[model samples]
Target: MEASKVIHAIYTDDDVLMSAVKTVKAEKYHIEEIYTPFPVHGLDKAMGLAPTRLAITAFLYGCVGITVATVMMNFIMIQDWPQDIGGKPSFSYLENMPAFVPIMFELTVFFAAHLMVITFYLRSRMWPFKKAENPDPRTTDDHFLMEIAVHNNEESLTNLLKNTGAVEINIVNKDEDAH
Candidate 1:
């Protein structure tokens, strides 16, 4: 990709960052990214991001997990190794279904939580050992950073960022980072 000028606006507090984001959006500027030390609730809504589909994926994974658990349990208990425990015959899957409820529930939650996290990381392009995309290290400590591409309106954008409670502003050339 060709190099371009990008603006990095830094804020010390998340509340100030939220207000600044609102001000920037009101001026019709596109925020490329925002780095936060921790999760900022409602920041995605303020940025006008669409709702994530991770929950849908989690539900599907849970269904798969429960189905697998049921099939595995049925195969082991009823089909492969049929045994009588305490003189109670374990032959009918329907009759012994209650015994497998805990396994089903645990597997459901396990699949939903683990697979959803993997899905989120994969969908977000945050695979293992990738180069860090964070522009400023301070953002990981106690600050927030907002990145905006400067498309020939550097002066105006800088002025706007300055007014939006930015603690520090830096102009970065994307060309230099490439090397």
Candidate 2:
């Protein structure tokens, strides 16, 4: 089921949120989601999220850009439309490559930036004009929220949440009677 259907508990304090997450994890509850306004120290580890590979992708994109730019410049200035203006050989591409530095640098940055953005969007399940499925608006502010699926353990989960210092508690179900 989608995480939006479960009850979400919001916290104003990071310490409280972290403790609650730890407690819930200890109990082996299925954590549906967590949201925070900013990166919390060590929160990724607490959430058990794996490390990202954006750096590797960026490096590969940069290489592709450089290769494309080099090939295009060589083909255009040396092979396709060779011109000898300064008594230099038309085939001397290696010596004349300094003139192509600007294009090469620009393409490298352009490819790296564009590819990294696309990768992040795809990884985060976001798209242009797509309505975000954020769990709670307060999570974009100073609040942190943690959501867990009750399954057959609502009572124990509530007790665990309260014990972990939740400022407010609300039980929710997607179907009727969850309200």
Best by lDDT: 1
Candidate 1's displacement at residue 88, Å, is: 2.6
Candidate 1: give the clashing pairs: none
- The Cα error of candidate 2 at residue 178, in Å, is 14
| Shift of residue 123 alpha carbon in model 1, Å | 1.1
Model 2 TM-score, 2 decimals: 0.82
Q: Give the per-residue lDDT of model 2 (tens digit) for 133-166.
A: 6656878988888888766666777778878887
Scanning candidate 1 in windows of ten residues, the lowest lDDT window is 82-91
At residue 74, give the lDDT of candidate 2: 90
Each candidate: how many clashes? 0, 0
For every candidate, C-alpha RMSD to the true structure in Å: 1.4, 3.4
Error in Å for residue 84 of model 1: 0.6
